[model samples]
Target: MNNKKIMIYGAYGYTGELIAREAVARGLRPILAGRNSKKLQPLAEELGLPAMAVELGASETLERTLRDMDVVIHCAGPFSTTAEPMMRACIEAGTHYQDITGEMEVYRSAHAMHKEARDAGVVLCPGTGFDVIPTDCLAAALHKAIPTATHLTLGFDSDSGLSPGTAKTSIESLGVGGAIRRQGKIEIVGHGELTRTIDFGRGDKFAVAIPWGDVATAYYSTEIPNIEVYIPMSPRRAKKMQRMNRFRWLLGKPWVQNWLKGKVDQKVRGPSEEKRSEQKTWVWGEIRNDRRGERRIGRVVTANGYDVTVHGSLAVAEFLLDYGGDGGYFTPSKLCGYELVEKLPGSGSIKVGID
Candidate 1:
């Protein structure tokens, strides 16, 4: 059992609770923490874990609490608000930091602080969740499979239900428009502006080009010149969703956003125990070496998106505990090589299907 004290901020949330449960099962003592002491108390007692109350916005209090911990796993969503301050506290305290943030802006901000983390000797790694781990890790594997590959395309299909946090984040990114890298530059593409039909073997599903954090990470991780990510959504709903997203400019109005939020809250429900049990996720990647006139494809499949997120977080925590230095900010793709991520225990749960 590792004696390092792990603190899981936002432990009362769905994903946070999953991480806390996994941490305990792995023989790690994780302190349940969040802005609400009242909620944390019950979870702490239920898990036989201690509770620490700290608000992400409260820098002084957060910093003090983080100082005594070896690592902090942040599971809060809409990371745009929480990632920065939490990162600052971790860097100042010289403690390892990790989060499940899928927001591109949040990742960029954390990446910017890499120098500070390196200087402080603390490990700062974000996106240790379902958002990019499975996809990013698979991208690394595909690149290795074809050393000369210069361009890559990746896609995911999952039966796992969406959580409220995920829905909110999607709504936030609406109207912001999807972005993709083209000819060595980031280009903004309207929702549904770029669409393709993907056959996942389950059936043919329509996928739209969407902005994802992988665009940045893959460009930096591999030699790929251009990369694109697609997520499958029903065609009938795609256009409607796209239209709403395009008008998301109107959501800037408080009343419109609030009304939309209420509607989404009612319609977008999180996974239930039964649904989570039946859920599975699959990912596919294609790598091409235009210079050499060759193409290679790779694929991976796994069960339970939330379970994968928990496993990914544990992988990061173990890496931080064993190999990470005193203080430094890093993305998972940067801290460890792609091979290391592929070799992770649950990684093999992914099965490859290619032509």
Candidate 2:
């Protein structure tokens, strides 16, 4: 029992439930946890695991529940709000912590906790999700393939849809515009500031600069001087979307956000069981070493984005179980080396294309 104990915070949410399901199937007993007991109880029973109620805002209550746990998989959404408090509780209780957070600001905050975690001898890993894991790991792999690489550009085309929580958070970030790293400094750019079209087999798809967590991860992972991450949007439509986002500042009112959320929730039907079963994501990355007069490009395709995220969360859990006690807050790239990248699940559901 002691060896099987793992807590799945936010277990009732879309991604959290998936993680709980995956954990149970792997013979790990997950302690289903979240703010609402009534919501988590049935899930725990359905999965045949114990359930505990936890609220991030209530630090004392959170700490008490986290005690004696071998590890915790935080699947809460919009991590900007939930990660910090939960991390504090984990450090206080000496429990190893991992989260699927992709928010750059949230990652910075978690990274700041490294010293405290190290002193306490507890592991803290953030961005163990689709947001940065595959990208970060793949970036590391590319850097190794071309040792002199100095810049990287990553893009992807995902047939999978976004979950409600993910959509909500994305809409919130719309007004903030996209961010990129140029010459080793973080730069914020307005929507459509930089646009290009890249062929992804299906056709030439348009992409725009987006404030993805990769900007933060890639800098720490590889010695690339410039890094930019983009998400595909149809060229014609991309322009329209940019226009809308540029004016998002006017809609900053809470009521406008609520309205947008409702509209988005209705339009973005998260990947259905059928969709998840069929959806795939293809990612491309290019590393250029101008000094060496060489460039290496790599590509990877995987099952549904959410599933990849679950896999990453599990990877973190496994890492923690094996070697996390040394402590310190760390990103995936910082914790594991090239070998870790190679060991990740890369079966038929995931394929890597490199050149």
Give each model a TM-score: 0.91, 0.91
lDDT per residue (tens digit) for residues 119-224 in model 1:
9888878888777787787788787777777788888888777676677777666757888877656677777777888754366788877788877767666757
Candidate 2 overall lDDT versus native: 0.78
Q: Model 1: clashing residue pairs?
A: 117-327, 117-328, 118-328, 121-326, 121-327, 122-326, 122-327, 122-328, 301-351
Q: What are the clash counts of all predictions, listed in order?
A: 9, 0
| Residue-wise C-alpha lDDT for candidate 2, range 155-193, written one tens digit per residue | 778887777777777777777777888898888787767
Q: What does the lDDT read for residue 329 in candidate 2?
A: 66
Candidate 1 residues lying further than 4 Å off, grouped into runs, are 201-204, 252-255, 262-267, 324-327, 339-354
